[model samples]
Target: MDYGIVSLRSNGMFAFLPLGQRVISKLVALIDEEMRSISAQKLSLPLLTSGHLWKITGRWDTTGQELIKVQDRHNKDYVLSPTHEESVTNLVSEVYPLSHRQLPLRLYQTTSKFRDEMKPRFGLLRCKEFLMKDLYTFDDSEEAAVVTYNEICNAYDRVFQRIGVPYLKVAGDCGNIGGNFSHEYHYQAAIGEDTLLLCNACGISTNSQLVANPDDVSCTKCGNQLTKVTGIEVGHTFLLGTKYSESLDAHYQNEKGKPELLQMGCYGLGVSRIMAAVVEVLSQDEYITWPWILAPFKVCLITPKKGSKEEGAKPWVDHLAEYISCMQGFQNDVIVDDRDKLTIGKRVTEAKKTGYPLIIVVGKRACETVPLFEVIDSRSNKVQVLSHKLLLNYLKEVSIEQ
Candidate 1:
């Protein structure tokens, strides 16, 4: 790919190059921060889970071909986990005894998940192996579990808001995850595969898959006509009350000192899928626009030709970047592109594609009486010619250069 973010492997798999990995790491960090705010504890799960665990919940056969099942040399059955409900339940229940105080527990992890997609396409959006952030909640009762579900869902809302995209929190089907109540977070885009019905009056959205009839359905919140929109699902939440816990006997002590099944819920955010979907929705015909926090670098310094007199401005840009890194704690937020063989025009074009929020061009202007450099604002596509001191002030205003 031009940007070197990801590449297609054999058929349904993809390899995320360094740039892609950096983007995923930023997204993961954001998700981790949001999860921790909800008092969720982080943990890692094995990529391979025992088939016996799925059998315990009767999902071993119910989960169609999408579930990737394999065998070891001993011929025992195992699964490349598509989800961790069964494994997490067994992990919690197998303990001698869980306590009431431990109820309302939240656990989460960001890891690779596997599924045997019949037809994978759209790059990382629908790949066989992808990164995901999944959170599981345990509570002493269904009421408490529902409360945890809403709390986590609110946290998810905060994340999407920070991502700076208008997303729909639509009522959705439980499907294979199987819970009575569920919601999906999606970004409406032309290439989206899922159909969403947006209410005309109250501006509510619901997944069409959950509605029995499209033509007959109306907004349940308000009696208004519904219009259809396509969307890419980026996140999902399920109020799984005692489904996994009761099936696996994951119990915690009650106030009466008796064992009671732990109510459960699960939340999922498609890490790679979101990265792709954000690009799908936000990128323009001429440029890629990443969310400011998710951009690989806040500023890219582009110097003139290697031997040209304009190249003198390179030191000024580098000195400023070094100062910002060493004094202001912005170590990896700025980069200097020293590919001087390429013309400044070509370099600027490539930097736009890389989605740098701000670009500093050190050209012949540095030799002028005022000695100014050009700053291009990708978000606004505006060019400002300012001297070194004003450039620093502008960067400080945008919170990028300074």
Candidate 2:
């Protein structure tokens, strides 16, 4: 479903087709649910901000050519935000009068981010523009900030687990967004661009960039043998204690009525990149092994005999579609493929390419007495003939689990 789901607009930009957008929508919904569970409020920030705001953090110069710079109609300079640290800091400083009581506030946004990548490849992995879920936390003290950091880490762990993808949390460098400490969650994929070394003895993982001696085959911390793993970075969390808060003048008053800088941390998840990374790791050939939860449509109803003057085959297909479509939980999640113009074989092939979790093809026998439907499990490549009631029951059970 490469081009069918994703269409490349330019060298580094892509537009998500309907099916691709559905996957993205589901991913975003999952992220929002987890963020809300942590009491994080969702907000929207402008896509373009004045360059002067970035200059306050000194990233305007340090970010180099990756920053997308533009000019306003009145000649004012602005940059497409690669992140929202400076913007969020400014917003908090202006809106939330800083107080110790207001400390440990978490705010997040899911928005489009821009970075002029020199080489954008591997679909959405390194695109110039992509969707991101970035969260910022403010606190009163460094000690309290670290606690909040751990909480966020736990929340991230829950998210990755819910996604059902294998990942590793390893020490990472805070390159452009400067911070004292950070951790990156990498999803194991053969096509990944980053290399990580995992300790065989202790389960500790380290990014190759932080390893002092790359040629060494042992973990420096445990002196145990290490195995190299290649993975795509999907999430990163940073403990930015007063970095942007102090620089951006986000000051809060302590209990003693003394002005203090807000301790801060930031977490980022590449929303669109997660979709692409999942595709890279879970898909084979043209079939995408969508985690049941992430599938665009849980079930597809194929009417191979549409427009035919057969023994009520098309009518049977319609009746089945209506029955499945009206099911309690799968109202909008079922697709009725009534395109009879295409041959039955071609329709089934196209549906398989879309990677629906379940494909139900209603053939001529479906109109006969004691009807049975052919159900295809896209991931296992297994076909089963089952009664209509059994197929519906199975779909509902799977949907409820997701």
Candidate 3:
């Protein structure tokens, strides 16, 4: 609210202001790049899906009220998508007869989803409407699907590792999704609602809900002592095998030219939930931090304070901003706080709270003979005064190092 990142919009919904939208856009770009690296094809699905498809998958009745069910003018039932397993499987069934040569096919989409939460709270963490990235894979056999599963898990780990956050992947139950194998990716945070049981002896992590008897907790792998930890779930991958494909008759032609159910897997990444969870994990007392790749702007160039002695430095500040914006890492990702009406102190404080990684000040130093600028590295809270040539080189070096 203070920095105009987001505006309140009813319960469980947020209106992303200019700054917030910029961060979301950068996050999407990073996710898309990773997906493409895995040879996943991007596509979109409708928000409203026919209840008939859900019924075929046996989830229409089992999903209960949490699934947002509705009806149209002709009295045909429909549902607002919580996930796309049923819809995606139904679509693939029509395009059947995939040859053995095209063994693995991956399709994915990033889109808005709807779920009826009993109580919506904690901003985007548990929301009625939010954005998500879901990928579905079809393989010729269970052996092949298992290989793809490991590859997808590795890709997921890379995403979090690049963000420079501490995260863990733990075994999870299939529950309503109805898969024999499952894993969840989480960021450890104090506000996390889910409890994880970790075994030190065998280095195993299991979801607390999966513990059938809390009084007798032990690692399923090594029969060792387990301790509890809290974590916010950011992503989940399910090795669904033939669950959806068999139910929906989604199949491919085998080497013998016989129809066989396609081995399938589904993976989900909560975009909005990760955004909220990252802030919860990285924010410090009075100041926020962001993943380097997800920051709204790489640098915030602050002009002289209103009516200050350095008012004559306007031209130099503008010139500096122009140069930084064209730099390799910046690529026009730098912004100038030209609101000269506000005090320089106030603007710098605002930029710090808003999580700009770098802040450059054009004050008294800018009016000096050599025209030195004050550079503040907000990420490390370090300050330095350097000449024009040195300042540019310093920023360029920082980008390369990252």
Predictions in order: lDDT: 0.86, 0.85, 0.87
lDDT of 3 by residue, 293-388 (tens): 888899999999879899999898878888888889899788899999999989999899998999999988899988999899887989999999
Residue range 151-207, candidate 2, lDDT tens digits: 999999998998897789998876665544799999898888889999979888878
Residues 140-166, candidate 1, lDDT per residue (tens digit)?
877888889889999999999888878
Error of 3 at 78 (Å): 1.3
* Superior by lDDT: candidate 1 or candidate 2: 1
Once model 1 is optimally superposed onto the true structure by TM-score, how far is the C-alpha of residue 59 displaced, in angstroms? 1.2
Any residue pairs clashing in model 2, and if so which?
none
TM-score of each: 0.95, 0.95, 0.95
List CA RMSD, all candidates: 2.1, 2.1, 1.8
Residue 358, candidate 1: Cα error in Å is 0.7
How good is model 2 by TM-score?
0.95
